[model samples]
Target: MPFIPTLTLKDRLPRPFKIRWLRELMDLVDELYFEYGIVHQDIAGRNLFISDTTGSILLCDFAFSAQIGTVRHGQSVYLGEIPRCNDVKGTMFFLYYLITRDPQYSRYLLSDVDENTIMDRPKWVKHAGVELDYDVDTFYNELMAWVRKRRDSPKLAHYTLAPRHFEIPDPPEDGMEGWYLGRSHTMREMEAGRTTLSWERPPASKWDKSRKLLATGKYADERPPVRLMHVPDPKKGFPQMGMTNAALRGQDKRKQTQDVVGTEDEAEASKRRREEADE
Candidate 1:
């Protein structure tokens, strides 16, 4: 096996966060579901690694990965066939946590909290003084927008299970809404003025094979051979790193909350404590 040394997105933070990178990561998720019929089942910053050399993101830790149209324990299972999942899998607040780095929000999402409770922004968000509602709304809007773009893309015509095309499941008679489920109107509205980010495919190189050999102790020398390979320029097809117009508008709308909401520092500190405890 090749020695793939990488750093999780969490470790690379404190630097500027790029919306395009997030879009690319979401694209990977869409590809896994639509093209490969695989559901990662775990989408978190810790599970996503960034290649140090290539600067491209990689999804890892597939212990919980599942496939559509598969039989498991004498039961048929199909995930992402429609909006809303029967099983609650994957890091529920991954995108929200990634953006806000707020432990409170993460904790709330991971718990068996009611959807209505979450939607009641004033009870929690206002009390915490965080613009979580705006953050979550923006994240979902962007995600749905990306899904719509990919579903309509001519290049992805081979994919039969596009998310945008997923049949919206019948609403629960119990009046409980599954926010995870996709809606056609939501997808369409998100795609109205959105543009998909471009990505360049990396060229094939011998660096991986060389790394494997070195890892297996095939070389007698203490020092491994230095190899130079072309690393794809990430900026070539990626959007510029900065906030977009929509984000700016959101910021403007939440200006009041921004002044009063200072939970970001607490969130960062909480995250650090958790990391330390784990260590």
Candidate 2:
């Protein structure tokens, strides 16, 4: 088998470059969960790879990967159904350990860390004699949001709207019976049978170009005038010294006549030279 080229995210310092890499890594994870219903289950620095040519992030080490709502051995798994696993099977805490190198923070991953415990408290880690500040609460919130979304749980919220001080919203009493599945739900579905709430108007229909133009305030109902300056016409032949089309046509005819006369003169001179040689 041919070897595939990949670069691991290990050994890279937590600078701006690595920070951007992590952001892209998270984007890849989001895409996988939302589009493919596949969870990496082992998202860490070493398991991720950056393609040398495309610069796209890749997730490897699928030993712990789980597929939701997929088929196995001719059995179809329904949507929102998850396989049971006794132990936790992800390397998310390894990401924090890589940044802080603190065992305390690593152990905190075993239990839920609330925002009250970390809002005013900032964890400090020393790297190369430089002290870096880590916001433990923000990290925990983001991690929880990511996990819940990957699992297709109804409790997942927008990243910006992730609960900071309070626990995430719980699934309905019916166990997601009427709850919309997947990463997101349409506004119509979210606001079903809600008469008190005011709904914002949806955008113009895609097929309605006039409405789109009106909405954007860039209506161009009339065609713009064409500007005629320094434009060449190949069918009229080359323009001679800024001459117009009529003048260019006259010049071309004259040039062609001159060339025909010159060819006849050359042929007559050759006949005279041959006669003289015969004499």
Candidate 3:
């Protein structure tokens, strides 16, 4: 998908914005909840974006999103029990924050906070700096009606099956073993060289970090000698050296080894060596 430049709603806060934009956001929430049968577990200022070109509200960040009625063991966030209410409640708190700029209600854990706490408030005092196209009542009334519609139509909200369902395909074989569930491979098979394997996108695990150790039976510790660009002053005499020429000569041969272990710098190696000596 082509990337479209957009700014988050939070970035544009305390500035005047159209009330219709927020209503559009509520429309998006309605579609995701009822039509798509997906629950965007996170609906907040940061996750909401206003298009730079189109001036429309765009909901992003599906990292915490899941299909409605999906329950899995070890999953921290699930929308199974309350299939359709998660996004609605989140939209309520988000709208509250947008108008009043009061984030105190949002800080509470989703499980602990009740949407009614905001809905039940007699009035929402808009911040002095904040501006909206329509009166606050217009927005609140529409939200109240949206919440009521969802609450009253429990049957529509609690549909066991979605209109559309998708299945995730199995991961293609990586040449380590045969295609079978939980099939175990020997250490030799697991480490089979990747030069023979064809991959669309190779895994970083296939890069051999310990190639020098495995081939030479000893790790490379020496770094390439630093060559000074300027000649030393004759008056001050030359600095003391520790096998500078031999270090320079072997530099070319150890280039490959250095390439593999370049991430470990000299300072870190010295610190590690000092720690080992102390031990």
Measured against the true structure, the TM-scores of the candidates, in listed sequence, are: 0.39, 0.35, 0.55
Backbone N/Cα/C clashes per model: 2, 0, 0
Question: Which candidate has the highest TM-score of all?
Answer: 3
- The lDDT of model 3 is 0.64
Full ranking by lDDT: 3, 1, 2
Clashing pairs in 2: none
Model 2 misses residue 177 by how many Å?
35
For candidate 2, the 10 contiguous residues with the lowest summed lDDT are 80-89
73 in model 1: Cα distance from truth in Å?
5.5
Candidate 1, 191-271: lDDT as tens digits: 785654332323345334443344443433447678997653332322123435554346545343423433566545545
CA RMSD of all predictions = 31.0, 21.8, 15.8
Ranking by TM-score: 3, 1, 2
Worst 10 residues of 3 by lDDT: 234-243
Which residue runs does candidate 3 get wrong by more than 4 Å? Answer: 73-85, 106-108, 121-123, 155-160, 168-279
Predicted candidate 3 versus true structure: per-residue lDDT over 171-220, tens digit per residue: 46555554433433343455774333333433447535754332333336
In the range 14-133, model 2's lDDT, one tens digit per residue, is 333334454566676555555555555555556666666666655677645545433332234442223232012233444455555655654442234332332222442433422224
RMSD of 1: 31.0
